[model samples]
Target: MAEKTGNAFDLNLFKRLLKFTRPYKLVFYFVAIAAILLSGLAVVRPLILQNIIDRAIIPKEEELLLYFVSLMLVALVAEVIFQFLFVYFANWLGQHVIRDIRIKLFNHMVGFKKQYFDKSAVGRLVTRAVSDIETIASIFSEGLFMIISDLLKMIVILGYMFYQSWRLTLFVLLVLPLILYATRVFQKKMKAAFEEVRTQVSNLNSFVQERITGMKIVQLFTREEKEYTNFKQINEKHKKGWIRTVWYNSIFFPIAEMSSSITIGLIVWFGGLQAAQGGVITLGIVVAFIELSQMLFRPLRQIADKFNTLQMGMVAANRVFAILDTKSAIQNNGTIKLEQVEGNIQFNNVRFSYIEAEEVLKGVTMNVNAGETIAIVGATGAGKSTIVNLLSRFYEINSGSILIDGTDIKDIELKSLRSHIALVLQDVFLFADTILNNITLGDPSISEEDVKQAAKEIGIHDFIMSLPNNYLYNVKERGAMLSSGQRQLISFLRAYVTNPGVLILDEATSSVDSYSEQLIQQATEKITEGRTSIVIAHRLATIRNADKIIVMDAGQIVEQGNHQELLQIEGGYYRNLYEVQFVSGIE
Candidate 1:
């Protein structure tokens, strides 16, 4: 089970949740009208029964009997019609409300900073998006209407019962105080149990997602048994949550039923004595009163059940609001567009840290001419990739000014800055989509020929063409259907088509094999021509031919020169990396 740490109910959150339904106000009113009509019909039915017994059925007056029978039938049919209308409108309103909420939440979440993803689990977010929304939707559609109907029914029934006989009504209403007290206590307990259920379900969802996404790793490590055991433990916790929920419901219902029976028995004994004492109430009125008492309790039972459902829905609403309320760490200027640029980049006294204890890049400064290829090479964690991230503004510098064409990057609009740079990473991620759509990123304006040319430039044109469907071939989630090398080639093609002024290749060719690497090397050369590029590679030979090589270590620049000049130094970090590369039999 996912750990239950956060509170779900806040008035401000509920207010926001209600705003999502404001658009469907008219339909909600229609549903409310239907419920009111239905409640009134329920009250009239018992009185109609009392009338039929005293005036029609007992006296054997055929005309009165037929008239009363017709009235009862009309009421019954009207009740059914209103019930359908009530359900239909509520369902319509609920679906649209949830749809609005999900869209708003989704848009908000995607805009959140990288730090949010770093802190929260993917599985938990997925639950908020999918399962939590579903639960809330159900509650809005059915639970809300049922509660309204039950409450209205309870009021109407009690009012009529009291008018009939105040003494007996008081006796029946006496049990209600105790029921209300028990309901309050049980509701608190039920809410806690339901909260646990929500947590466990989220945890189970995370576990399943982790296992499925990392199935290859699990199989390779032979940890299936361990995963199974962990899953079983979480499943048991989930079961216990359900068990508590059931225990509460089971005990509460029987107690409610017993209390209801006590109320009914009291009415029967007291009403019989009144009838025996030459009271105005008839036997039929007594019978109707008995039925009316049952009617009162029936709606009460439904109200209780609906109340539980409302609690669950509120929990889900709280979670959904929690996500919507989160502020993205990466702030963007209000501007919508950025001016065109020549792509001259500068970093002045830049320092950055992903964590407090360790700085990734420290006191680094560099300048890139409009169209120069700057290759960054060093051992892993030497701040090479960190420089790429900083340049792209994925992570803001702790202290520094990164300027594009002399304008501080912070001043330039975020989307505009990103549009100028196309980043191709080593770990390629692809959605389940056609190759063409993946390359174009669902932009319908891009021509098919352009996509193909980009693929050919990346030297993956032949591989794609060899497939029966060619560019129409579907790539599975994360490109599971394609090899790592093929996915990388597709990503390279995607960046090529964008034709951005600044290109970033962060270990871009690291995952491909030797044969694929050679093709990538040639393709990289073609694509990097006349484009400002930052290449972060462990392969020293890949960057040896660049215009400049920047060697970084411990967030600081330790060496800066052409590869040949760095190689001339016998003992520098670049020289040592170069020696290791050549000794490892890499070209």
Candidate 2:
């Protein structure tokens, strides 16, 4: 990413943001036309006021006065209509553009590689998708189009001021150079401040989100005071960032107001002298000049404020585009499809790492025939889980190949490959939803009957039915309402309902009570009966009946055999692991 600088307007970034509006170009153009018409109408009101004061009122002609008054009313009504159109269309365009961009950003994020998320902050991404995108919408609703309309209004008013009396116009413009210089300095300062504010907002969001998500850890460690102090520091930084913008505004606006006041004073003093000196200055012209001068300076003040909005929006666009532009590390170039895979899996000299030069899986080779059950046993960080992760293609292997039915998994289409496999992780994650919905996961094709059947097969139907709402019972967030055992049962039902050809249970029974483990083992047997199953378990007792047992140590397979055959080999890795677990009962 390029370093952010103090540029009030980034043309390239603005142009890129405009591409999202292309689909709504007709509405966008209509908004533009409305802005122009509104500016024209703004000038007409001042002219009508000038005509009434100079021609109709001063002449004491009641008929002409009524006629001019009627004309002025018509102009005022027309201005109101155009103003409504301007506000309505500008906001309408902004909403449509933001909707399109938000969808695009979401789609881009969904396709990002797992590695990208590994290093990214969830809170920061949420801020980009929600808060930052909202800021971009203001670039149209309250920034770009508003600024343009104000500028056009100012130009039309200036033209009228000069037309009325050049001498008075010159006097009124004397204080403008000071205002212009102040505006330039203000823009540069506010741009830097707004950028800092955005960064701090994102930081504050990240800190709060992470702390809340891990609140249990905070309470367990009794670190609430420490986390609160840290949060205060982040919030203070955010406060300071916003205060800087306020400070600039506090300084700039008063200067602008004082300059505007001085200009009005100069116009009255000079125009009065011209009238006394027998020049062509009239009461109506002087009155019109006052209105025109206010019109001219009002937009100048607003431009400074609107320009700040525009700058903040450009900064937000830069952050969002940064995510959109990132390329996923895992490429999906395979086109091959499978009607049904036989579930024969092979890992041929597979070597992999989550990070470079920090190998997690060394050159490992393994094979399983169709419909066989294989259990992988290992200590923590011994690459047992990594093996299953590679099988699912969640992360790419560093060397060699992983294959199903003798075809390299890299050659298989990602969606089709993943469709045949179901993974039940040790840490079960259930959405805040009903039991039936959690099991089916919003898959319309998976009927409620199918879910109930799957739950019955897994021995969880009675437990679910014991609840007040039965299958309709809500699990709440991350299944907090359910016990660890209940959540595991739900996950099993979910995996079973999918009817996957291959099942992966990654330490699924390790965290549950003995009764829950028995139930899980029963569910495991039914699910793994006709499928190729790979179970990664730290509890050695859970995999005793495996058709084949593979012992892993330090990212390499050290032993391979059935449970009894491995236990017979004295001091073998599998024997040692089994003795350490079942004999000591410390697992």
User: Which model scores highest in TM-score?
Assistant: 2
Scored by lDDT, the top model is: 2
- Give one digit per residue, the lDDT tens place, for model 2 in 23-70: 888988988888888788777767877788878888887888888889
- Candidate 1 lDDT by residue in tens digits, 534-562: 88888776888888898887777888889
- The 10 consecutive residues of candidate 2 with the worst lDDT sum are 1-10
Q: Count of backbone clashes for each model? A: 1, 0
Instruction: Give all candidates' CA lDDT scores.
Output: 0.83, 0.89
Model 1: lDDT of residue 420: 83
